[model samples]
Target: MTIRIRTALLGAALAGTAATSAVAEEWRLNNFLPETRPETAQIEQFAEDVNAALADKDFKLTVYSGGSLGLKNTDLLRVLPRGAVEMSLMWSNYLGRDAPALSSVFVQGAISTVDELKAVLPVAQEIYEEEYTDWGVTTVGFVAIPTLSVSVFCRDEPIHTLEDLKGVKLRVWAREQVETFTKLGVAAQIIPQEETYVALKTGVVDCALYPALYASTISLQEVTKYASFLYPMASAPYTLGVATDKWESTDPEIRTAITTAADALWERTNQYDKDAEAEMAAREKLGEMGVTWGEDFPEADRAQFMEAVSETWQMLAEEAGGNAMDYRARVLEALGR
Candidate 1:
């Protein structure tokens, strides 16, 4: 079944209900990423830390990875508010349709450098907290995603410039990416990460825009022969959110434990230098796997791409309506753009 159909059915079945039992504080943390991913490992550690902190209490945090809870990432905004799930690691880009303002707070290509990302995060988090609270979810803390290098992974030919991308069917992740690439006269579509490898191998798409740090996770190196540097994708952090009602009703000590654990997770992952080092390591691993790397995209073309993506940010904010533009302005102000 399509993700939308599956999400709708699952949402309906669990709507207006608390999925977690009230007898104990055993919370289910839903992670949409695969169990093999490092983020899942970090989340698992966070749960362990929280449990340790609350050792004397009857509180436990169980992490369900790889969508094992039968919950879709896109359905999180709807289900989280109703307490259908007690906790989730939510990425705002996946939630654009339901929480446009939240998505508009930051876009991957909007900030190119790690310093820019660091400068803009506080403002972004403020906006995220506001939006999540309005949606009935309490933000505990955020886990910083590594600032990975984005690349154009193509099958037969290299794509390093705007001209080369014009006729190529490119796979992107978010609507903002689709709009930006489309503005640059490229045909870009949103394909899920799981399907991207097959899309390139079977000629469903000519190329894909993905992070070099994560290409090996889905074995993109096997399908795409040529890869070229695009930009450093500094995406917004993953939010560790709990159903607000559940949070409020919990014991004060347990709440403190959860908060402490979440804060430590954020600190552990927020190192800019570590992010760069990891990306470099991942890129090297991709090369050892028999993938051929192309030349860096030209500075002129990078500038043009960023300009187009900036326009897309504004378009998304206006489309989202209701304080989205204001949020964007605040983000820009933080970046001094």
Candidate 2:
């Protein structure tokens, strides 16, 4: 009888220890960008910081870069809410189909200068937080992509102005871009990043609007001969979104550690002026690879482009419905435009 009682007590203790060990399992973070990009390293560093911060809990977050998890950026809104993936790096521009209002809050090229971006970011973050909560996910942190110059990369033509764009078939990533270009009398089509190279190679698109920072990621230098700077692209931050339930279930101390580490990342990326320097370096590297650089789009034409894009912004807000126009109004007012 004594031996049996001792065995039962030992089994109970072992089961409790196993349950506690199971609580320290790894969390997965899905990053859509290729490992070559600087942002990927920044994210990996964030994970390391987070792990260090929560060392006592033995928590780990393994980052899967380049979409190795077989998930699409466009599907994050649907998958994230259901906890299909514990966490993901989300871009609002790609989530428009599911969260139109959130998507219309801001667009690339909406703001030109670092001052302008800083002025309007607070408003943007507020709206994003509210909308993401409503969508059944929450942002633990945001990593701002450097404000690189947006440019036209053409396979066989030199495109330097809106007039130049009108004659060539252009590839764009978002509906807002297509509409904005269309409003300026340029014909553009939506093309996914993975498919953009094939599109450019096969005469499907004569030019593509891509940022200077990551042109080499898609081997644009191999396909495009002429590149012309259009405008500084001030994209919204990439969100580190976790399922709402998952976040809520996390221990409060661990949550604090995660957020504290994330806040550090935001400060490092958002409050700095590394964008122009980084963009210049990337462009020089692209030039070294034989991409012919064209003159920057003229200032007179840039004004016209901004005007057309402003109108498109209004149209996008109206189409998105439900406080989207309100959000746009808030952003415009913040920009003091």
Candidate 3:
């Protein structure tokens, strides 16, 4: 070929390369947990897996951990529907304002173990699908963080029975938790996670209803003397969601690649929670630091606790109205309650 023909072919090749680069898709995934947490690492791995799956396709995913993007966990669900962010690993219960049914999973006594959660997840996902569809978001998948039982950690007292919790000021996260504690005669204060450690230390709250792993994560063991496993209050169900329109418009193959990666991440994270090595080690460390763990509640007290929780569930369902009552019924059936 002549020099002119060769130059023309080189120009076309460069133009194609630029076009490919220009069409490359970049997605942002936000997580509120610090990078040190296992869940955050799992989110990063998900990004890596998706990028690897689409390596040739020029799709890139960037993960922002520890709320570095400045979006609070509660804000994720609201902003996602508006397309302000591409993706997020959000706490399902935090979406109670928009979708109260989603909070059913976090209801006290609703789900007690990982196996129970797995059983209820399908129905929960169905409920979530309808809710997200209405909100203009799509759920990628449900991830079960290790079944961290929300236990009570007190500075000077251990909550052994229903009587122990009465009249005590306890810090809580969700409205369901607040309602449950309030019915038990406990003064429940809604406090953000970031402020919990100080609240416990400074006597802002006498006790806190939070996960054992999280207590370990924030070093709550140092300030609190006793950890009560009286009630398996709630389990953390982390959800990954994306903008619905973005998902619908994406290439089907890329969506498949991302979803496949998400499924694997879910399994890995679930197994990590099941193994409970980290939680065990954390408890051990807390013990060394003089934190005492309370024995399980006596059978009678346990029964009474569940009865109250059941009542709270009914009240919540009634308050939510409409599909919420149906959703709560489905969750209870799945849990075999």
Candidate 4:
């Protein structure tokens, strides 16, 4: 409607074209997130660097944001392999059915810190290469993401422990989430991202398991308050992958440029992403928004949750079949387990 809005839209449109155009080795990327957010912005910047690296070469990269390319969070793996999209920045957990092996990275209490987590990606990605290469994709690298601290934003009291979880209705994504919480006696509504805010406002769901950064991004500061640091559940991580066949088809210079740039970007962001200092700032901001963090759930409840969630790890491992053992073994070995 206004000039500023029109200009912003134009910029986004051009951003999408970065993946579509060029008279050479063309690759298209689709992201199901708004570029305004930190994660999405970083993705676009990666695209820019990739484009610059390919400038002299006959190769090109384009990025489509907000799912304009018709790929959902769960569709990238299938779409990428079938030649529908060449690359995507997706949460590998959302690719569960396509490659359930990925759940190991994000499952509750899988690994406690970023260093231990980053150590696992290289090997785990190899174990699941069949899942991606079968679809013509390969993992480039993973981001050291902020831990997925499951939040309980309610019009009710604070939920800080395992006992506090009973009878509570929470929101989740994967089927494993349903089983995990159900075992904890939590009723889960597997809802999409867009529906979560409304779900909270309507009283349809009272609890949500997401990262602290998301609370600020989605303006949850407006409604809910009091996030419990579900210790083991606090961290969640994911990777960025590209179509293997398509990637191989690119000019050598272009490929090297893209990978080198991505590596540097990942290495820098990985540490900064998991810095413990960020949490204190996040808590303070949320508090400023009128939400009070409470010690409603006690340490005993935390111990109970840790014990209960180990079963989920086993369930997830079972879901992955043989892939789990190899993936877990390598990560443990890397961590000196």
TM-score against native, each model: 0.89, 0.91, 0.85, 0.82
Which digits, one per residue and each the tens of the lDDT, describe model 4 over residues 236-280?
Answer: 435567778766776678778778777866765566465466667
Quantify all predictions' global Cα lDDT against the true fold: 0.87, 0.88, 0.78, 0.68
Clashing pairs in 3: none
For model 2, residues 119-148, the per-residue Cα lDDT tens digits are 888898888888889988998999987877
Query: What are the clash counts of all predictions, listed in order?
Result: 0, 0, 0, 12
**Which candidate model has the greater TM-score, 2 or 3?**
2
10 residues in a row with least lDDT, candidate 4: 230-239
Q: What are the runs in model 1 whose C-alpha is more than 4 Å off? A: 1-25
Q: Per-residue lDDT for 1-337 in model 1, tens only? A: 9999999988976763544433456799998877878888889999999998877776788999878898878889899878878899999999988888876788868887888998998988888899989988999989888888899999898888889999799999998999998889999999988788889999999999988878888899899888999877788999989888888998889888889999999988887787778877877898898778889899998989999988999889999899899999999999997
Q: What lDDT score goes with residue 202 in model 3?
A: 92
Better of 3 and 4 by TM-score: 3
In order of TM-score, best first, we have 2, 1, 3, 4
Best by TM-score: 2
RMSD in angstroms between candidate 2 and the native structure over all alpha carbons: 3.5
User: For model 4, what is the alpha-carbon lDDT of residue 74?
Assistant: 80
Compare candidates 1 and 2 on TM-score and give the better one: 2
Error of 3 at 318 (Å): 1.0
Between candidates 1 and 2, which one is better according to lDDT? 2
